[model samples]
Target: MASRILAISGGKGGTGKSTVAVNLAILLAENYDLVMADLDVEDPNDHILLGVQLQNEKPINIMLPFVRYDDCIKCGVCGEVCDTGAMLISPNGLPYVIPRLCSGCMSCYFACPTKAIVRGERTIGYTYETLVQLDGRSFRLVTGVLREGEEHTPPAVIAAKERALLTDGDFYLIDTSAGTSNSVATAMDGSKLVLAVTEPTPLGLHDLELILQLTSKMGIETWVIMNRSGLGPEDEHDRVVRNYGSRIVARIPYSKRIVESYVKGRPIVLLDPSSKEASMFRELASMVKEVME
Candidate 1:
């Protein structure tokens, strides 16, 4: 079966995109094969939130420069060719390579005349996979965790996505980082559809607009899910969101029970599928299916 990759994204943090992505994948796994990937490598929380113990933690390596001191010409060629400023030429004309700023492009190594630079691998993050059982349906949860002090989230996101692509499934639910930067863009690339989760608060509205703007520019079809809906009533936020021409596929009302279940690491759908929040998610799944069909 053709895989339906759905990217869950929001421009700002604390919008519940990962919560929705994980639960939606669990819900869909009841009748279809599903693989849920947490592409937010900088702060991966899906596995923790799901209470799944990851077993296979594999290191993600990226290229770094290894200077061959014996072959060095002290020409400062590597520093000049680094586009990311990873290599710095000191006042004394000595080159210093900063591993963090390096994008693993290896351009400096290839451009060196004396072959003084050699390409080496550095561990930037780790990719993990685990099997989670939700409501008797078993599904895979894969995530990438970037090491502290690392600025490359896009590479780790790509590593997690590559692992997800290896699994054959009916659906791939990708939970992206909360931003408009390269990390979010890398996760959403090649996705068939995107679900932008937002809240009714002022900040939520602003970030939702930003996310919508970015997604529209990518030519990707998007649907919005307004969380904590009815916090203020009168559908003011709904009207404002609709003005952007994107339909609100679902609205999960603010509920203490939903929050409590999430804190307890239990799927709200399992708590009571007939509850308001659970029903809202079900409606969301149905709407997505209709669109994909």
Candidate 2:
């Protein structure tokens, strides 16, 4: 059978998206050959949590605008068209490019009548591939890391996703950047299903609704994982999930053992496969396999 991409995402950060992704990948690999793609270019830490070094690194660059003074008109059109404020008109009326602010959408370039904008490449991030072996089961992990100063994340996310697709696997599990912004959409673009991880806090529920709205628009199946389930109000969270037509497939309480496993650079699932936490992940994986099959 051809491979499918299953995305694990959440609207807010620190909700354990990466942890769920790595553990689910580890368990799923037992039944199906898998590749895990970490698309959170902003703060990728799957390798850290998995305790594996990234291999086959590749730099990713984006197009930066080069302004030609010769063809320049003092027109404010470039600045007006720049959504990211990368292009700005100086006091003298000439537009200058701010590389960090540039999303490389080329909107300014297209909107410029003088053709003063030229495309230049800037190395913004890197993509990495490594093999992770756990309990005699191995799977490939592809991670995208954005440079510290880079503002645009979608390109890096796209680059890492493409790298994961090149590998041979029965299932490609995608760990997306937090939030329901365009970058997250880029990572979740072709996913077969999305496991949306969130907590029961006010912030968590707020962002969860936003992501659910996005996925509903995309017409993708999404299941909720109530991470840190006992931290806050569950009734409101349940109402929100019910309103979105998404079921809460799993609930993981905040546990010190989970924290210890994270600190020790080992998945809790690996620490004791027979434990309740590990069984939760295994059952989830089994449900996914059944659905996909």
Candidate 3:
């Protein structure tokens, strides 16, 4: 089996990237061993959509400030060495460290003259891996959850991808966050192909362009999925997208049954792969397999 990594990303939120990724993983798992990674560390929803309980969640740690006050002369060296403004020097000549602003570069601790700064660990996120069996076939699901108020999603996303790679599966489907930020880039770095999920709305087309630009810059092959295709008669957006050299591999039509089944945590493909939406997705998956082969 060949290693094939597919990253599902969109530049904007509510574009159904996770939905496409999850369903694609479930469908592909029928013929290939699948490792599905939820790299949307900021707010992972793949597990929620799959209705699978995430077990063995291990906390992911980040380096934080550990101050040694005993050896202290009130030196501001740590504050001056910090670039993120995580460390602050008080008017009274005391130094304070804000963990939130810290990037864990350890520059402050390295530059501290009094050796008063030390590295400490903070729980920035958690990662979990589980197996979901559908139709007598089991697929692996790995996800990372970044603690709210933390800003280091890129690392967590990378960690989750690394964990997924350990599954040694033939197919790896990565569900990325909704943005073209560093986190999305990190999640998409090593993908063999990327499928950008979008709706037929103006906002969806707008972000699809942004994500396409990102993928172009990265030299990654990309395809678009125009979800909710019948929501409106805006064919111009689709035309504009194709003009940019990316093709729409699938168009999932808007259906109340799809929405309700999604709310109930069921994969649309499983409900009926012969349905209009699922058939389109299957066609998309077939195209993906052809590309990989």
Q: Write model 3 residue lDDT over 136-199, tens digit each, in one string.
A: 7689999999888998676688778888888778888889999789889888888889998888
Poorly placed runs, candidate 2 (over 4 Å): 1-3, 73-76, 111-114
Clashes (backbone N, CA, C under 3 Å), per candidate, total 0, 0, 0
TM-score of 3: 0.92
TM-score of each: 0.93, 0.92, 0.92
Off by over 4 Å in 3: 70-77
Against the true structure, candidate 1 has what lDDT? 0.83
Which pairs of residues clash in candidate 1, taking residues 3 or more apart in a chain or in different chains? none
| lDDT (10s digit) by residue, model 2, range 127-203 | 99899997898999999999998888888888888888988888989999899888899888888899999998888
Candidate 2, TM-score vs. the true structure? Answer: 0.92
- Write candidate 1's Cα lDDT for 119-211 as tens digits: 899999999888888668998888889999998787888899999878777788889999778788888888889999888877887788788
Q: Which ten residues in a row have the lowest lDDT in candidate 3?
A: 232-241
Please list the C-alpha lDDT of all candidates, in the order they appear: 0.83, 0.89, 0.83
